[model samples]
Target: MRMAKIGLLLDEQAAVDKWAKQENVFAFYIREVLDHLGIPYQNLSKETASLEEIDLLITGLLNESQQALTQLLSFVEEGGTVIHLSDSPKLANWTGYKSVCGGAGYGYTPKELGHRKPVRFLKTNHWYNGEPAGWNAKSGFLVSGSPAGQILSELWTVIQAGNGKIVHCQADIPYSIVGIQQGVEPILHDGEPAPDGTAGIDDGLLKADDGFTLDWSIDRAATETGMKYFSEAHADKWREVLVHKLAELALEKGLTVPFVGRWPEGIEHIATISHDSDFNLEESADITLSLLKECGVYSTWCMIEPGYERPLYERIKQEGHELAFHYNALEAEGGLWSESEFKRQLQDLKSKADLKTVYTNKNHYTRFEGWGELFEWCEKEGIQVDQSRGPSKKGNIGFLFGTCLPYYPIAWHTENNRQYDILELGFLTQDLDHHALADTSVIDPFLEEVKRIGGVAHFLFHQLHFLEQPKVSEAFRKLVKAARANKFEFWTSKQISIWERARRKVKIEGVSASGEPNVSGAVSGANTVIWVPVPKKADLAAEAAEVRYGHLCLKKILSHKQAQTS
Candidate 1:
């Protein structure tokens, strides 16, 4: 394959040049990494480069010029690929180019409002060939319209001019772009392709530049809707594509697909339910559990347990559903408690009941703070997981989909020499908890990130919110179904027990060592304990008989399912 000569246009900002040195900055770093990888390339600022010499043009948000954009579009018309970064979509649209922009959020740092900010990942859409199922953004725009609003209406128009591709991200960079240029693609642990064009392999290594493997299920579903208008149907399809694409990328990369399994991966159906002090979750829990049992799936409930009935927790346990600590008390307290106090409170709450496994801990208003301390506390308390991190203006900033799946906390603290149990399973994307639900397209980039990092996606949901609005429920249903259809295994907190066992087995056998696990070696066919969710009315005796008598497969028991049944 012939290497394409690349051109970059940026403002006089010295930061842009500095950013170019970092391998992860996709737009700026692509030039240097390509050169190092033996791929020919060239870099020129907007002030110096001529349009004719550039095969692919990349520009910062501030350096967008109408004349320059016009010249670049002309170059694309002449069979070139112009890669615009930052807020260039606005300027490109102003120059009469039509572009599809999605995934907008508040800037990470206030200084990057209008400048080039790193986009987290790119959503798979039409126009790009072999485009990684997604891409990471270094400096993206704070879009003016909706979350998936039109930042570059005209950029899309120009994209249609020639057989060129245009990718506009409104989020943060997805993965280490530095790895991509080195021929290491980011993929889910299960060997799916990553958004950033990386592939996870069985050898536990990422193979970069796999030549664009399209996720057929995702692509076909997304293409069903016209890319022009943002319809609910279109949004649904986008979610399906995003989930499947991520899973496919993970499988391609040879990593364990988090949350979902590999074979006939459990039903992808999921529900998100929210509640406050005024309403109780008893009825909601019963109904949801019943529905999930009928579907052969599990329900993961994010509960703001305050002035509600305590029995609700038991009901969740009784129903074999997952219970997540919804930090409404923290939210209602107005961020007043110190880290020590918060940790103590969390510990106290866990002691209240046999509250399944505390797989996820989310804030009521999504206020994630003192995460370093929370993680430490979880470690000290032997809490296995904490799914509280997300893109919050108040919480730590660097955690934007950095650890989307369940992983050993890189930031855990130990009082003694003993290893503390702590895992941070952050959300894939923030749920529209309070306001009217927007298009599911907003989460496309996030789903791509999940695939790229081989992470678990803990989606947030409120029972009242879904019950009041069926659209939200439908959206949730579609996402789960799509994930399952793509071979993603749906898991509740209890199911995390199974994951814990699998993870431990991998760790014990050194399977997840720096290199690959010896699947065909001594560890082949090793029996690990796996958790399965049984219905409230499920015959516990029968279920046990099935497992003991070889009628069912058992992995591990991280939680007290036997006690609950008793």
Candidate 2:
């Protein structure tokens, strides 16, 4: 394999173990974001390692050393790109950013509106896509730095060296990412939440609003959604913007970075539709099947207690669909939100489905009990993916869970900061137009955004909704047609999880002179395609599709068709 031009400051797993031991889960997240971007990178052995062969470096620093600082200054003077993530005065000095008090807030900050100097919780990141993209800081100080450098969104400054540049973020970006992606753990620790809309219950299950509230207070401001109960995940676009910034920087320094395509075979974008059979009825199942069959789409159908009959389950799979478990923990619906109950229900559903493997699950009514516990249970039950984290309310829909990508959930605040084995197949919205609060207004923009970034647009529907709601049925058909016309592929939840996991093992074994990357990895049924960033369009194959994608920095996002298969 070729040596990676970009380097992360520490061993990925070791950083997690090392920084997380101190109980601050936000200290090590540069590597996490890079991995999410699929950018190939090597880990620097030490903070002061040689940078002769490295074009760019990204590091999240809580503290810095004089010697390491001296080395970094020297490296930047010699035209090396650096994206320094920290508010430490030591690191910020050389990076040309001054740290000032940002006004303390937790999970998110207060929004100042109608004031002369409005404090923006989320700011548009001009580096990634000029004026179109935005990300936020969970908690951090203000950006104060050299006036000579171009400041970005009041959070960072961009300083140009002889042949290099540096973007200094005063806000701790990695911490914000962790806080947004995985919500802050409740102080109560699932000690017991009052049942929904009732007084406290001793069920030991977390309430719907347990893990991810903005500020742990009433009437807190959020991403301008005007809801006291809003999600910061939508504002947490740091990971995507940061990685893209790194890619642009690498290209500026004459490096071709190859990241695994988000969708297999270089498909433009992908989507998944899943139905939760809350009532476990056959007519709804038949309706869903007929609807999808008409549109040439395969879907994942999650079954609740006593699942669909064995024949129905078999038929679902036979027709190229997937059968998954829908854990019902709504106490009002005879739900016992216990781990044992989850396992028993999962096992029972599998038996009814006559399945050797059931890899996906989405809780009934999105009833989540605890953070990390559900993921742990899924891991133990051999479930590969869990899709329980998404918006259930109208204002919270679309990018409310932070991302549409399927990623492994990280166990925060623990000694290990362990990355779980199961993939969290998070969705954008549940039904396009079903719930009483179903706002179909967010659908078009969400789908467009997902395609722009090459991500999955998972949509959820209830079996009963399809049968009873005329609007839902109309919305479903229109969604399928629109997605197909827009060149999106509809995959089962199981297939999405499998493909995401498989891509982790892909490697750019070699690169061609035309900036094409040769990949190695056996994709059982799909051909492999790699996306390579190159400066010169003439260098790439004449027929290959290329798009000019960047903010200020421009690079041809050349699609390499060098395919390999088993």
Candidate 3:
């Protein structure tokens, strides 16, 4: 049997960021765990291929790719399985959909939809191995003309295109939709498992003719009640459900899923630290760097040049560290330094030290109104990467809040009515800059939100924050530990080499499709050529010394020549 290929269609940026914030939660952690288990999966985007190559498709309502939906139906036709989950069944308009609302809190509060009730699995004379049913007296009603209604109304659909099966669950209930492809007789009534390994007539388990059974017996009432009364417990259950379901899905699909890997599991974690200046704060930098180095991690330090201690920057570079400009242009009263000045500053820093990369974090939450200028400068100067996209507002001057994940920046030229000169490497994510230390626990929740949306967790930290207090250090250490324990791979800005290589390959392969300018050749030439700075010296030599006898003989010859001339 060939290994199954599972494709998850989600909002990639949102998912990744969400996962990072909630790394302590099981759902966030399981993403890494599943990847460690080697699940073959990829995030579905506009560029993904057809469903013929995929065996399973797991999607949520938030995943709004029409291409994905079309491919999902095709995969099902190819004898594949589709699992759909959402707060409302109204979202999924695909075929073979049956929704059952109202679960006994199920560890989630069912709002405007209805009241909480116990969810049960029922066996029906249909292709589905198990059908989910809920009993909520308040609003346990089913849609009359919806997908669920169609499935419940028709015994089966003529297997056209392919032998595909879809299992749709409404209201986030627990149930498995496997074994429908195999020919089996469906049980007519709902049943429950016996107390001592026996079967009893209850409304939870469903049996089929071929010894295939669907079990929905995970007890969650206690968890639900706990969540209702205690806030933390509820949060815990939410995480637990997400993690357990993801794991179960991985197992059911029989594929190794990665939480953070190349191609699919995108950018994992981003570290933030302060830069040097008159306010250089050496003690803080020392402590933070020491702890990170001890843990074998290299983080990006956003230094404010001129204010930064040049010696410290040199040391950081020597230690194989990365440096990004913490632009305090406003503080420096640089009066919105021109793009040329910015390029000159960056080049000067590179010349002074063996620096390889740069990121920018403006002082006092400063943002450049015209990012095109900054991006153009970066491209022209071969500054391959940047991450100056923050202050936590919904949007930057013109960019989106979460739009910094290593994409090629598009520059439009108005005169020619065309676009040109894209950046090789772009910003990823930025930290929520409004909070202070210890109060930074909000980072976790923010990371969780990023993970859910498939965004990178770029955290910004000040050296001063961690230096004064061990508590901050401890908190950061715990965060790192949790991230690692959950399988998040640590990377510095330099490691973006992996992303660049992959991106270049993709760009080269689909130049036309990307519609970006073809300046690779020019960029490559500039990077390869070397220029020597020092001038060459002219040769000069002194006459060699001679022995006394040799000197006497030379004088005699010179006298004879002078007499002949006279």
Candidate 4:
């Protein structure tokens, strides 16, 4: 059997089960990763043609017929790759491993020294504690493979049967990625976890709140899913493992796996600074604008409607800063669902010449319970992008969709087969968490991780940061300087929005060597990123590129010099 690009096999019933029977959570993270890599993939149904053209088959919650299994085995034998998820008995049998039954939370350790660095994560399911949280930590069958097979994790094994390899991962990695979980049951009126229940169970799980008061200091479970290793900290490690495996498979077949590896214009990563104006913080705006001007950084200003100093707003626009709406959609007078006051505020903002045409918005207090309704309002109002997807009053400040990039959060509208016209730009870190700590030391690790993953460092610095917290403002300056030192591109919120929109339209063709790869359909004036995976044996001197997390990128250019063959 021969393979093409990547083939994703999803069981119809399994998809339904994981979506509805489980929760509304979809496999967004997996899709995000594929999109990030710019790897084209197609969903394989029962009626789909021969698997011969599929180079890598990622099977998810799919039950297979014996004939299908035989075909997959044949495909593997022909040097194709197969990744099976959770409790696959057939895979266990083929790989000389058996399922071990027990309570959830048992994690895997890298038995092979060669696999240790990439698989630094102890458990693939735990996110916060490095141990299982809540009941049944989403554990699965432990794979006891034969001597020939390599045990990457206690519950995962890779067996070389024929020319191809079979990867058996006994964990619900997809579920963890999508965050399908039993949320913490509210105990007291304050929405704390039930004290009488199991320890570490739902104690620190990410909760959807009405206010932006979720305790960031607490080392809570980032995910309520029983899996421990599926949290934010392990995202980079997992991506590394998958990328390495894919590269190895491609090398074995004497083929190079092409992907859009980095940020647009070949930038390694991006640093986007934005401010949300909500209260009597107009003074903060002046200071922030001054500071940003001194540093030569352009940022975004999201303001609450119905009020603002006209001079300050005009000056922000004069300085080339973006103006965005900071809506309040929560309950009471601030309830965005109420049309009477909401429309009036919208009218007021629209009447202001400086803020009238601002297309981007972030709800005051990060409110998004009625996001669907708000999206409708935004579409009707001609708002193009939204930054409302964040910690909110009740959610964690981690990657909600396992990505720092912008995406269409259309999965929430699956029932109508409708998609929100506005792009969703998720925030990375916020000042709320930093302000709580009175310093930025606690956020250093997170910043490093974002750099490691080459993800967008989208910071949400409130007006308070510039007004009340000088130290936090200093931290912000340091962060910007650090990003510059690290060679990360600085972007205004509007630029990021513009670039992400352009990125969606851009496509990555196959690898080229002669000269700059001509990328068609690129939005003129918008930076377009084209990425290619650098081989381990490739000559570094052959081209001038920025090496980021293994992939080599040519910033602000469209050129790729193929590895010279001896």
Candidate 5:
């Protein structure tokens, strides 16, 4: 077995590279994907045209001289994989595929002019939360039809060349920065068109008729597309394809397969129940708390003005429930706020509610605009997790992040390439919207989806909604019982956050030159996953002394051949 060395071509003369230098969206995204899979990669510079130990070469469209082109072709001829981000004329001609030079993005009709399209896989066309809710788009491709290779995605096509493989992607999966620069417009978050037609942004900020200058950029467009495009779900589409293809290559060369496990301890399914305390109404809180107690589930209660209900807060703490701030009124006046104000409000609530640390929160009304300011303020106030992001509008209530996984929000603006310390737990299903339609059954399908994918079924039940309609309480109790019956592990938001942080810290520390991989780290009481590097023909067995993935709830190992066949 030989070490799998991935070489990333940093083309200085390429336009994409010039754009990435300013934003580094593509490189950053690629690194994120690799990090998620625990695969090590290196940046190949112009001086270093070829690497002796490189197993795979990933680069954008090749615009190099014939000599340089010949070297790459020779590398492929000698058995090496090459993945081109866009249509490569040289590679297409070499591989016997016609590469047409035409601009894309015409005749693609997005179902909704301004909303998120579900992160659908190109091969299976399956979505995480069933029938592709949110938004849809139609885009033309530069390389429409590949004669020999399989089309992994409508935009990404892969072909076997000699002993190697060439994967060419026409669409910008990492189009976060580049798409915006090219004036690629998306629908705003409020289900309205943005000034320049961007998705998932505040309609007020881009108000041109009011004479407000549009301060938006391609970088800002990435920030505004929170749960939509440029998100973890959207990025995972391309990442999964790459990993599957690489695994197949590994199999062909008798190398070990590498992948990132989705859940902690490999648990197949999980649920995190939460209740937002929008109003200081103690009766509704009491009813919901009683229901949770009967169901034997500890939930996170996001409170809005805790000073008004001291006794109830005490009772919640006594009942072993987590207390999180519901900061709405404080941030309601607008997106402007100082850390002092957040600190003062948090301290006042802590002193009144007798809370030790208000580490989590849900913004009142889910107001996340001025998110950059709000998240910075949360860090200053010592908040670790916030579940304020989700679909607030009527038609937008669906899985926005595609999965029920919590993540750290990257601040493209103001943070200078830094992600906020606050982890984002996305809102899945809320009580108000579902209750308005008198349907708690809307969550059933999502739960089923979660079970299949080994994801979290995060539910947001409003205390006021329960008080307004007692039937909602009954619905919740029934749902909890069903979930328990289905073997869903119920978790508090804080517990999930802690487990996520610990799982991310678990990494492969060393890999020998012989291709032996060593992984180490453990999360207390949670299932930790370690990548087992086995030969292509070897049975999936643990190579080193560590926790085996067998103990955890595991999904099927997606092989390259399987991906192509699918």
Candidate 6:
């Protein structure tokens, strides 16, 4: 009952029922979180010999196989790890979760902590009345001036059974993350207000920020360091809980887990600065470009219709910056949200480019209508990355889409809700300057969380705001400095897109406990990261090249001969 890596007891039917049966879609978050965490896993739903070679088994959604359940119980009795998600009536005694309905269904939240509890959040953050606008960078970093309380909803029960352990979750964490990341009733949302500056739920115009559950009035929170941040992205932290538990349980069996680093070159974190060239703000391009040059990093320029003049565009490209599209759907700007309209602006922006190639797009005002329409348009436009899913209002910033890192949106139209080809590079805030939320206090804490989870910290600055607005320019400078403080290297969206697409090609072979992966296809030599997870930080001190996301350690693994030399 115990030999190989973690066995993901998947339920194929769950995907089919995701749209009809709300309970089934809860399983979606588990696979998503596992993928994002970069954990080593084997799917047991289809084409598996037996669980005999598996040490830890995570049962997601419904299980129709009773023989597997009997084997699972026996394995647990024999000291194998079994983690039951959603609700499991048979696992009640081991999980310590009481029946919610007069000894019938499983519980929602844990009544009390179990014997073998995992570490809870180090700091509790919340949203209430917070720091007001006009608080400049010099004002302070920590935004704890406001009163708050606990905002996260995850609760767990862990019990030391037989020779192993049983971990249970009653709140349905995966479902929550999926709901937050995707949306609860985005497609059906109509009456919801445009509080985030995006369209209302009923607007029928699907912007990337559609169906957001994080309330601007309540969900915004600061880091434990005191810097303000979007409390919405806390889902990433919740997902990380599984990463720790996986490694902790595996270590008890004297095994180590391997994972891929979020970035190459052994870097702990990444940052991206983008400028939306609204109405071709060429007048402010020099100042914005100069600021980027002073920071010693390239950026992405998302251009709207009638882009910068050929000369300025040439300079931007010559400087090695990425030139992308900023699709305009604002009616006042004489824009439309139709597919034909999107294609029109895309073609127009591409024509304005020197290279005639646009790989990325961040919609004008982050306009989105449906779940898959924007992604589908991007796919058709040959765009590989998009930054449209973010908050336009200052208060609505920070992981509003439930992640700061780039991810492929799950295509709900598909039977399996398949991941799309385009990468969604969700930005934290647009126009961090603007002379209003002029403070850079939120930068560090956001970076701290990004570093902790191996995620990207992306910021958007409109070119026009860099010059006329003195505080806006100053805010940009402070942001770049704060990024440097966190040791986060700045990259353009193009670089991120290329790296992500390339990173997926890297394959890990030889899946035994020895756990040395025969990796290949790392295009960026010396920069590609291959991570290994040990129980302790000191596990691979001398040989370990770099530490990465989750408990995974070890360093950059060279996949080719050139990589070894470079």
Candidate 5 global TM-score: 0.69
Residue-pair clashes per candidate? 69, 2, 49, 23, 9, 17
- Provide TM-scores for the models: 0.41, 0.78, 0.41, 0.71, 0.69, 0.79
The deviation in Å at residue 381 for candidate 2 is 1.5
What are the per-residue Cα lDDT tens digits for candidate 6 across 52-125?
Answer: 77878887754435654566667787878876665545445333444331111111111121211122221211
Q: After TM-score superposition, what is the CA distance of residue 506 in candidate 6 from its true location, in Å?
A: 2.6
Where in model 6 is the C-alpha error above 4 Å? 1-4, 17-26, 46-49, 65-79, 88-154, 159-165, 187-210, 215-218, 222-232, 354-357, 413-415, 436-438, 510-517, 537-541, 545-566
User: What lDDT would each prediction earn against the true structure?
Assistant: 0.38, 0.62, 0.37, 0.54, 0.54, 0.63
Q: Distance from true position, residue 399, model 1, in Å?
A: 9.6
Point to the candidate with the largest lDDT.
6
Model 2 spans > 4 angstroms off? 1-4, 11-22, 48-52, 77-79, 93-97, 100-155, 158-166, 187-237, 439-441, 536-545, 548-566
Tell me the lDDT of candidate 3.
0.37
lDDT of 5: 0.54
Sort all candidates by TM-score, best to worst. Answer: 6, 2, 4, 5, 1, 3
Q: RMSD in angstroms, candidate 2?
A: 7.3
lDDT comparison, 4 vs 6, better candidate: 6
After the best TM-score superposition of candidate 2, give how far the Cα of residue 360 lies from its true spot, in angstroms. Answer: 0.4
Greater-lDDT candidate between 1 and 6: 6
Question: Candidate 4 versus the native: TM-score?
Answer: 0.71
Q: Rank by lDDT, highest first.
A: 6, 2, 5, 4, 1, 3
Query: lDDT of candidate 2?
Result: 0.62
Per-residue lDDT of model 5, residues 9-78, tens digit only: 7554553444555543233344454555556567775633766788877774355666667777777777
Which lDDT tens digits does candidate 2 get at residues 1-566?
Answer: 23248766643443555565655545455655666546677778476577888777776543266777777777788888777665456655555545443422222122211111212222122222232124443221242222222333434556677666676654555655555566656324543332232223234554433454333232122333332222223323445446555655666655666666666554778889988887778998888888888888888888899878888887888999888888988888788778899998988887777777889998876667545778888989999988887755554455544567787777755535667888887776666666564455555656776775577888898877888887887888888777887888988889888777766666665566655466665555665556665554333335455542342221223222333341
For model 1 the local lDDT of residue 3 reads 20
